[model samples]
Target chain A: MLIKSLAAEWLKMRKSYIWSILAALPAVSILIGTANYYANKSVLTNGWYSLWTQVSLFYGEFFLPVLIAICCAYLCRLEHFNKNWYQVMTAPVSRSAIFISKLAIAGIMMLIVQAFFLLLYFCAGKVLGLASPFPIETVGWMSRGLYASIAISAVQLALSIRIRSFAVPIGISICAAFIGLGMYVMKLGMFYPYSLLTIGIGALSQESLTIAENGLFLAMNSLFIVIVSAIAIRYLSKRDVVA
Target chain B: MNAIVSTHNLSKRYGDAYRVNEVNLEVHEGEVYGFLGPNGAGKSTTLKMLLGLVKPSSGKVVVFGKEFDKNRLSILRQTGSLIESPSYYGHLTGLENMRIMQRLHDVPDKNVCEALKIVRLENHKDKKAGLYSLGMKQRLGIAMALIAFPKLLILDEPTNGLDPAGIGEIRELIKSLPQRYGITVLLSSHLLSEIEQIATSVGIISDGKLLFQGSMEALQSKSQPRIAIKTVDNETAHVLLYRQGFHSVIEDDALIVKEMNDEQTAFANRMLVQAGIDVIRIEERRKSLERIFLELTGKEKSL
Candidate 1:
């Protein structure tokens, strides 16, 4: 059932702007980051780390949350816009399967987006002639970023599913991303799911997280996904889709 | 004919008002059950409960002789429905939309093609659903519902947005369904005429309650024909007709003598004239489905 649900979701999305979004956002970040790297090439000592610093800042601060929000919103848009909720809910499949299948697909799509961003980052570094060895640390940071995105996807998915309007969820994403930024500035990013992205990526600020802080980061991401996913499932279970 | 669907004292309330009262419904196999009501008469709500789109506030639904609440998925697997409006992915083509439903039902590609052909949408199967007109979309919705070869079909106002010719085509198709596929259908509509020609059984509802539920013949039998007599001496004709063991009233400029046939029509005309009250006109008028539907719902003022 999950496989069927996933297949249908993928087919529906493929016919829409999903691919363009996955490719476009990361490509934009890379191009902008490459331009920034060239402008400050004279003062930079370490090439890969400097490049990571410039690009990931934009990726973490602005693009990442919005990307997750748009994907999540777009994921629910077909059912919402087409008013197919009642049709879908009346199907033989369980709502839990439907909700989780969407969640699983969102996680997978975001993972692919993350992989694309990483590849773009590497290619952009080579294009800048930053021939230094790959800073394997950035891979660690992006893996952490993936965990944080799961957390955002869970809650954002819940919001997208609960609300029918397209722009509302994306609007919430923009405003919440700024709050995440504020929390990060206060060194309180560990408590907020949206803030976990920048903190996890080791972008925005250079201070290294203590091992204890790192454990907290992993725990928070796991906790948010579990709790928010539970809430989303509960919402779906109780939802009386009138469409 | 075994009962394929039965609801027991089902009801749905919002706040203090009843959207659907404690009404029981029975639909038999090999039946095209026409669910009829006027607008805002809880026709849609009743169908929604049967489809499991909205949970009932009280009572339960039984489909295929089992508890529907416990066997929801299995029951749904055998049931296909279109509630209120057509649902489609505008980005998908007509064939693609049918294909998606086939995937959900785990059916073959041939099912999609055949279902489209049934609705005559196979010609435009490649067109995007967004561009399809309302009638086309409605046909496509029926195609999707029919794709799985479901044992039972629940169509809510399926003929809502169709031309007269399209409506007649759909009527013929529905009339052929029980014999062609042996599919039992529960279809709801506010327009009595829409269902009158196709429904084997009719369930009439109004104001959150079931007013009448029986075979179409049984319902039509409820409409009593009367003798329509108009005379120059109206009051004298009234008194003279009453003297002959007939009760008559004036309706639409004619004297309406209830429950009378051809013999009585002639008898009343003779009686009125013999009493020096000349009869101007006398005719037997049988009530139409429209009249019975209006009277059944207590909205007789409506056509």
Candidate 2:
């Protein structure tokens, strides 16, 4: 079921002609980052955090989340726009499988967008001639960044599924992004939804995360994701589909 | 014979409005059952409940001897449906959509070609669904319903918006399913003519109630017979019938009476002739489903 669900979403993404943007975002973000790095070789000493903060904001904050929302929204747009939720909900497959399949797709798309961000961030660092900072835990940091982004995408998926209006979910995601900034500072980082992004990017900045603090954050955020997802999926499975 | 599908007092209420009010239905295996109703009469809502797409506010739907709520997946595996408008991803080819759904069903044999052929859409299977005409799209919807070789197929308004030829084609396709594939079909339509020609059993609904449910023969037996009379003075004949305490409607310049058996009609004919009324033609015609429906609903024509 998971594989088929993944395939279904993959088909939607590929057929919707999103591959161009999927391929373009990383390339374009990387080019911009590399050019910025060359223009400020003196600032290369400012370390990987500042350089990455500069690069990832373009890829991560603006391009990546929007791309994630578009893919997630588009995945649902197939059902919403064509009124195909009625078609899909009636299929022999269980409603849980259908909902989970969509969730999996959204998560996978988030994974892809995160990987692209990491790949471009790394490429930008190399082109800028910045000595690799904290080279030992690069994989760990990248994985944490990906994990946080995925959790955020889970929240986005739930929001997208519940609302019928396309722009509303997208608008909500943008607002969440801004809210994430404020949440990152309240020292209640784990409790705030957006703090997942900051914690993730902070971890990648070589900030030490005490296992207890990070674990609590992970647990709280994952719980938020699961709760929201359950509500959305339950609503979809139960409510009479108007379409 | 076991009923392939049965709904026991199945009702769905939307706040104050009851879309389906205690509808009791029984569709036996290998039979083509028709649900006939006008727009907003809840045909689609009832179907959605049967499919488990909409939760019933009350009552139960049993399919193949299993309760729908408990055995939803198991029951759904043996069933296929097209409710309301057919929906498919516009970007995907028809074949792709079927393949995706077939994969979800874990259906063996991958008889996508055979399914397409059943709807006569094999040649156009590779085209995007967006490109297909309405008739073609409806046919593809049927093809999807057949792809898994389900034991029962539920089609709602299968012929709506189709041309006469398209409607005829769908009728033939549905009729052939029982003999050719051994699949029981439950189809709903607002067109009484369509149901009259295709349905073996029919259930009529009005104002969210099941007005009647039985074999076509049973429905016909209950219907008021159509009385056709050809007279030289059509208006005078109509007035004379009214004056004689016989109510009749004007149809194609003829007076059409109802509820009169052969002997009563004969006596009326004798009286008309004796009254110097030139009756060129007098015959009892089969009551159309429409007239039966109107009469059953107690709807009267206004002056």
Candidate 3:
């Protein structure tokens, strides 16, 4: 059932010009990273994680989360148009299945977008004559960053589904990113959902954080994903499909 | 005959007001049922509840002898519907829209071509649905509804915003659906004439209440007969008709003479000739469905 719903949600997102936005992110990120690397080659070492931090800020912080929110919101908004919500609600599938299918697709897309960012970062590092360093930490940081994206996706997807407006949820997710910078400055990053991307990825790269720090960051993100997603699915199930 | 869909004391209330109040409805298998109501008359809301789209504040919907919410998947597998506007992924082709819907319903093979053929949209199957004309859009909508081979089909205002030809085509398509597929259909429309011509049975609603529900023949039988008379002598015709105890009102060049039987109208026609006035035409005017609707809903002030 989820497979079918995922296919349907994917079709809806693909038809709504989401692909162009997804494709554009890595292209732009790569271009900006390449230029920065070339101008600062003397000061830079052959560090994959360092290069990722430079490139993925453009891809991850600003583009990736907003893209996930847009996709989820657009998936629901398409139904909102012309009362297509009526059709979906009347279908034989369970409402929870419908919500999960959309959530899964958003998660999949988030992973794919992160993969593109990682691939571009690797290519940019090589082109700028940087050698690999702390390969294990680099891999660890990338995996944690990507996993944190899924957690972030849960919160954004819920926001988009509940709010019913594509612009508002995307706008809110972007604003949350900026607000996360303040939390990071205050050293309270582990408390907020938005700070998961930074803290999870930061712990892997900093190499100095205690095991306790890593556990706390990971736990906060996983808890946020579980609790917020449960609330969202429950909220969506109770509310009538109004489209 | 077993009812494919049934509702008992079904009510939907928004706060203190009931959108549909204590409504009991039944649609037997293989029948064409028409739901007639004006705007805000709760026709759409009733359909929504029956389809399990909206949760009723209080009521039980028994579909196919099983509770609707309990057996929703099994019951819905045999149901098709077009509600409000037919919306699709605007960028997707008409065929793609049907294909995706079929996928969602878990139908293995692609039925896009077949659905398009049913709606006479075969040639336009590859075109984006958004680019189709309004009538074409409606046909595509119907096609989508029927694609799953549902046993019970529901259509809400299916002919809205269509030209005369489009309306006729939809009416013909709806009329033939029951016999062709051996399926039951519950269609809602505000156009009385269209429903009168096509529906086997109708349920009329007004102000969140069911006014009447019965066969089309029964509704027609309750309507009064009217005769339209036209004369060149407009002033004399009014004075002479009024004086003869026939209450007649002028409609353009014709005077619609109400409250008079066929014999009385014939007698009035002879009196006009005897009075040296030429009767242009005197024909029996079939009582319109609109008239029946108005009378049933108590909108008519008098006969």
Candidate 4:
């Protein structure tokens, strides 16, 4: 059922500008990220780690959350346009199937954006002519960033589904990003859903993650995914598609 | 015939007022059940309840002999609906939108083109839905609902934006639905004559209540003939008609007397003249469906 819904979801996004936006945000992050890395390269030792230190922080903290939110908001924009929820709801699928299919599609879109970011980050490092051995830890940082992105995507999906206004979800995401940054500064980033990205990406950490920190990150992410996905699915199923 | 949709005491309340209050409705298989009501008269609410778009406040909705609460997906599998206004993807082209619906319904691609041809939108298939005129948009909506060729089709004022010829085509299409594809239709309309044209059974609702539900013959017999008289002296005619023990009410520029036949019309004319009141005209008129609709809804004064 979700596969069929995804097929349908892909058709809706064919001509939409969401593709450009998805590609553009990562480009912005890459541009800003490599620029800052090069400006401070004299004080840095490890080239790839130095590159990630700048790039992933900007992507994980700001661009990633808002991009996830916008992807969700645009994915649901069809439903908001011309009252398409009433049409989709009457299409013989269980309400849960409808909600989950949307989440799954949003997750796929999030992956696309994350992948684009990883590609751009690597390309920028190559362009900077960095000669240090490839920092395999960069893969862990990007994967964790993707994992934490799904958690944030769950909550953003819930918000976009409940609120018909598109701007509200994006606005809420902007505020939450700054708050997540605050939590990151306070050293309690591992506990908050918003700060999961900062902790996972090791943005504020002096060194790469320890085994203990990694376990905690994985545990917190799984718990958040289970609890938040359950809540979002329940809320969406119970909602009345009055439009 | 077995009922495809049966509602018992179905109601939806907002605040203290019932949007649909204790309405019991039955739509039998292979019949076009026309739900007739004026605006804000619970037509949309009742249809919404059946579609599960709006939850019923109380009562049961049984589709295909199973409760909607238990068999929602099953019920919806065989049913398609259009509520109030048509819904479409303005960004996608007409054909692309149809493809989306086809995928969502998990049906074959063949139905998409066939449905577009039925609505006569095959030529405009590549055009963006936002550019389609209101009538074209309405046809696209109908095409989407009919694309799956479901056994039951529920439409709320489906003829909204169409020319007279387009309406005629749609009426003919609806009439052929029962036998051509064995589709049972439950459509709501505020236009009495529209229902009179294609309905097999009619349900009249007003202020969230079902005022009448029966065959077309039953509705016609329920409303008897009346005399509509225009006179130079309406007040004098009323006084004279009252003296003769006849009931009459003064509408704008006309004196309407109920239950009047040819004999009563001649008698009223003779008596009005005998009482020195000039009778300008006395026309014997039959009760039209519109008149009966207004009478049933008690909105006679509402122009």
Correct interface contacts retained, every candidate = 0.53, 0.60, 0.62, 0.82
Task: Give a tens-digit lDDT track for model 1, residues B17-37.
Answer: 998999899999999999998
* Candidate ranking (DockQ, best to worst): 4, 1, 2, 3
Report how far residue A165 has shifted in candidate 3, in Å.
2.4
The best candidate by lDDT is 1
Error of 1 at B89 (Å): 0.9
State residue B143's C-alpha deviation in candidate 2, in Å. 1.0
Better of 1 and 4 by DockQ: 4
For residues A1-243, could you state the per-residue lDDT of candidate 1 as single tens digits? 777666666667768877798889888887887788788888766788888888888888888888999999988888886668867877778777788888888888888988999999988988778777988877778889999998999888999999888889999999999999999889898999989999998777656778998899999999999899888988876656765
lDDT of 1 at B24: 94
lDDT of each: 0.87, 0.77, 0.78, 0.85
At residue B240, candidate 3 shows an lDDT of 98
Worst 10 residues of 4 chain B by lDDT: B280-289
B1-303 per-residue lDDT for model 4 (tens digits)? 999899999999998999899999999999999999999999998998898888888998999899998888888888878887888889889999899888878888788888898889999999999899988988999999998899999999989989999999989988988998899999999999999998999999999999999888899887776688888889888888898888899987789998876787888888888878787777666777788899999988787
Poorly placed runs, candidate 2 (over 4 Å): A31-41, A131-136, A203-205, B223-282, B297-303
TM-score (chain B only), all candidates: 0.94, 0.84, 0.79, 0.84
- What is the alpha-carbon lDDT of model 2 when measured against the actual structure? 0.77
Tens-digit per-residue lDDT, A180-229, candidate 2: 66766667667766566667655324466788977886787678777877
Comparing candidate 1 with candidate 2, which one achieves the higher DockQ?
1
All candidates: DockQ: 0.65, 0.62, 0.50, 0.71
Rank by TM-score, highest first: 1, 4, 2, 3
Candidate 1 has an lDDT of 0.87
Backbone clashes under 3 angstroms, per model: 0, 1, 2, 0
TM-score of each: 0.95, 0.89, 0.85, 0.91
